[model samples]
Target: NYCTPYLGYPYYSSHDEMIHNLYHNDDCMPMRGFYRWHIQDPICFDEDLKVTIQQIGVGYRGLFERQDDVASVAYWYQAEPHNRFPKLPDKEERWPR
Candidate 1:
């Protein structure tokens, strides 16, 4: 489960440096790195039972490179302004797979 601060949003450190260091020790082979963001909401059952439900989205990255290449790539998540939680279209909705 993901954790958010008591009063503010959470922040994650970029793993680019870690990946770069690993590549250097492994003879500089190309590598791909990935991470994901999850929205956690508390679910209440009766009066005392509770659990966290998680909604996972697309994978994101703070860094990506071809090892031998010089260019860098980064990515992150940005919530849509109008609809903080987007609703699935009726035709695309499903109960279970």
Candidate 2:
């Protein structure tokens, strides 16, 4: 079961479930995709913020950690007078393996 239960949002459930409710049924495609959370409910972070991802699975021996490759992109709106942005890596370095 690939569930995305994070923060206080239990309704997120699985990737397919969220995609089905947020977008048209036909809009969902397998594999490569992304999900936006601010659509249904918005979260306000006034202070520092941190994000983490975990992969767990169950088997005959019981629950255990699993290894997986994941990629993510985040978008946020900040107040005026923002700090200088950090330099980015070269195009070759930034490319996915």
**Each prediction's TM-score versus the true structure:** 0.21, 0.45
Tell me the whole-model lDDT of each prediction, alpha carbons only: 0.41, 0.62
User: For candidate 1, what is the lDDT?
Assistant: 0.41
State residue 86's C-alpha deviation in candidate 1, in Å.
Answer: 43
The digit string of per-residue lDDT tens for model 1 on 1-97 reads 2443422323433344454566455554434333333335433243353333343434375444322322223333544674465677687465333
True lDDT of residue 35, candidate 1 = 35
The top-ranked prediction according to lDDT is: 2
For residues 1-97, what per-residue lDDT tens digits would candidate 2 score against the true structure? 2335333322322245455465664454333433455645766687666778887979899999977556777667878998898899999998866
Span of ten consecutive residues with least summed lDDT in model 2: 5-14
Supply the TM-score for candidate 1: 0.21
Where does candidate 1 stray beyond 4 Å? Answer: 1-6, 16-21, 24-47, 58-97
lDDT of 2 at 22: 55
